[model samples]
Target: AFDPPRLSKRADYSGQMGGVSEGEDVLARWSDGLLYLGNVRRVDSIKQCCLVRFEDNSEFWVLRKDIHSCYHPECHTPPIEPEVDPNSWICRQCVFAVATKRGGALKRGRFARLMQIMKVRLPYQLSSLDWDPQHLTNQQQCYCYCAGPGEWNLKMLQCGSCGQWFHEACTQCLTKPLLYGDRFYQFQCSVCTNGPETIQRLPMTWVDLAHLVLYHLSLCCKRKYFDFDHEIMSFANENWESLLLGTLSDTPRQDRCQNLLNALNSHKDRFVSGKEIKKKKCLFGLQVRAPPPLSSDQSPFIAEQPINITHRRRSETGAHQDLLISTLNSVLGTESIQTPLNFSLFVILQPFAKWLFDLKGNGTRKALIMPILQPDAVT
Candidate 1:
């Protein structure tokens, strides 16, 4: 099995960073690219990952490269102030799920915890054509200077501000290391680092509705799907005029208002919305049902060949699947996916009840479980 490249320069066989003692304390990086309080419970020597149990009593395996420390176990001197918010503690997995589900529509509260993840010692000058979905949001390893598939072996660094990925070699970095392996630094890309003359820097304290949408949508596109509904509702809750003005507001690209729906229609492979319609006997009596949420080809195994696995079952890579289910179940505040109750799960996932209820009439087990995997089709 292949492993992803970790930024760890000196990870060790022992659980903690640099072989700090077992059951020791450490900071763990979540999907949104920020560190939070967690402690080392055990180590997966084979995967070179650690079983990190966070302060909230949630436990999962964090890649060794994603683990670090500010003041404990490791000997280090403070250069800059500790960056992560003391009050920013929340369910890290929940943050990951919400961010992924909404395509990174982070509300101001959840958005406040954003901090520096890694610095691009070198910057990639992107062409006007470089801003497409393929280059920016689609890849696992981003914020870097390449178009290559994510290589676990490569030493990679990600820009904390814009979330652009960088290959260590491209950074031309010799000095100015992470200094403390804390997984942090005030890093920006060429576009961001070049100063406000080149682009407006998103304020660290208060990011308005306009900036949140544009910044997350335009830059740091780790999550591709932007929740326009969330953006508008958020603006509407505050001020409707701001909603309209915010969409038309200036962006680093100096983009025109063509981004309203055109950009979304083009960038996202699909859009999903559920609505209940009442029919009062139409003139033609035509079936008024909406199109199938997923095409048969996409939502396969409802009746046929299976991926040969279930949410409970795993294959050669099943452990990872198990880990995901466990993490999501924990993050979602659910007991098990086998019992996907609406109140117990995240609101975004509430629709699963209806879908699964309908699916139950068909085949059982894997056949029912398979279609639920296509998130693109489901969402």
Candidate 2:
């Protein structure tokens, strides 16, 4: 039998190159008819051996003592050094999940990912757009900037405790800076940042809520979904008459009344009140089937009066859906009168409407869990 060309020891051996240590599994890759092993060891003073070891504990060695270089003549630079400092470096395997770019995920690389995640979360804040589902009665139950329809360009919001994700616009509050390595990055928004520490979070002023509701209503109108079933649109239009009069009443009630009369004269052909019916139905439906009451503990989620509510119906069918909606419309529609009557209406009817639609479904879990393969993980 012929002896294989084993890596026999030469006359000289330095053993300088750090070869695979005992108990360390080695990796090998073959390309262009050449075998590349994980480690090289010098076994002879005048020659070197390429040692190959398998994850299963097999081992083999080859002598390259007399071989010349230049396998790829086109390549000019020598191989780069590996990262010895674990703190400053992450393996290529861990680089995929970061967003280190100027705009969303437009850029990549470990460093960039770290920076991008840090920027949005940092103390310096960016833009905010408020939103509330017209269908919901409790103002606190309205979706905030994160969950609303604001376009975050698909950017994700990171959770405070678990490094999980949510749509950027849906997040109510967040903490800043994702801490990794030596540096920390600020990332949480105002809501997340101030939530627990602060006292009763003031309700979003009616003005701000109105603006948001109106803006979306116009958007829906543009889409021709004139189903007139949107609570938001109904709210805006119902308030439209009162708001206009209120705004102008600041000038003079006479001037405000004059404008209303003139407008009614010009559009005499338009059955504005008949149109008001459609708005009423939608508003009533929303107030009836709106989301459940937010926890009283959460100051941010409280319901404020002077909201839009349109109609009334008996809670005969389980669809208390329609009745709940009507009650909400009536609550929202009632004038902000400083009388006992107005207060009574708000206190009595509003809670009932909110209860009808306050359906709280358990949230879905979408967190990602990485598997560990070491004893340290068990610890």
Candidate 3:
């Protein structure tokens, strides 16, 4: 869908006759003839191309004619929007569907994010409490499986894929099971869990973030962790089976997590599977910590600060990775889970729980919630 700019029939142009070398700034043409910022790893004067390495570490032999000196780019995004007659509306959707579907157009390139803008139907409902899945005619909707919506409407979560609404009570979400907890919130229906590539179980970013947290967890030393928090442990215990059989990730590192979870699940029969962990108090973290009551109404313990966990970096090692995986294997597969690694994971994940599942499909987050999460500082 992208066309290289200003192609010339002749190769020997006045551009950069001195030739590129390692560490010099240059733009290199990829296989598609599109130029991207890449550093010269080495020059090949015989072939009139240099071995160029892009930021992602992928290397390519880029031709001199296609190479250009680093300067301002003419366009930041591709001009891939199909040329259509302004008068014709039907062909646009039809064209995009067939083309992108068959790998003919918009093949998940650098600007694939631009595609998220297309095909999104903002559920034009007044209140989720009153909205019916029946009203969302095109997309399928699932409510809690009691065969009825309960008397009170808890918060309704929509799937990141398929744009369907779900009652949080109906889904065993690992990210945010509790109402008041500062834990991450998300939910996913079984379709997202098991369906085709079009139906994502969780947002790619969330999966990547989870893996990043795990990656850093591999670097944690025993001394950095604080007092144990059993909330995440409880949450995992309650939802272990669902997450094991359901959660999936396409990324390499994140896929390792999914594999570990599955491996843990296979050994479930050998584990204790404690019923006591289901108690809500033990499963969720961040309750208002208070001193013991001194009298009938007053408390004695004078501690004011809450035990909070934050983020940090770590050096990766074979032992560290083994420790992190073994910790998860223990936590998810057996009862010996309350380790420093587990607590560290709890904090790094922002108390990772499963209620944020629909942010991928919730188009509103990009426009609305982003401002709240990351507001510009007043000068």
Query: 7-111 in candidate 1: lDDT tens per residue?
Result: 322435343235644688986655434456788888877667789889889998876645665322222211223564656543323333233211112323442
What are the lDDT scores of the predictions, listed in order? Answer: 0.35, 0.28, 0.32
Q: Across residues 1-379, which tens digit of lDDT does each residue of candidate 2 receive?
A: 1121212224221221133333333333221111232443323324344455544445555333221122221111111124346466442212212322212232335554433333232111112212233222222111221111112112333223222223422222222211111011123433444332111222222322332333344343432122323454345445543332223325443343344334323332221222445553222111111121122211112223322121112232223333444533343443333322221122233333433235212221212111211222321
> What TM-score does structure 1 among the candidates reach?
0.34
Best by TM-score: 1
- Candidates' RMSD to native: 17.7, 26.7, 24.0
Candidate 1: C-alpha RMSD to true structure equals 17.7
How would the candidate models be sorted by TM-score, starting from the highest? 1, 2, 3
Clashes of each: 9, 46, 15
Question: TM-score for all predictions?
Answer: 0.34, 0.19, 0.18
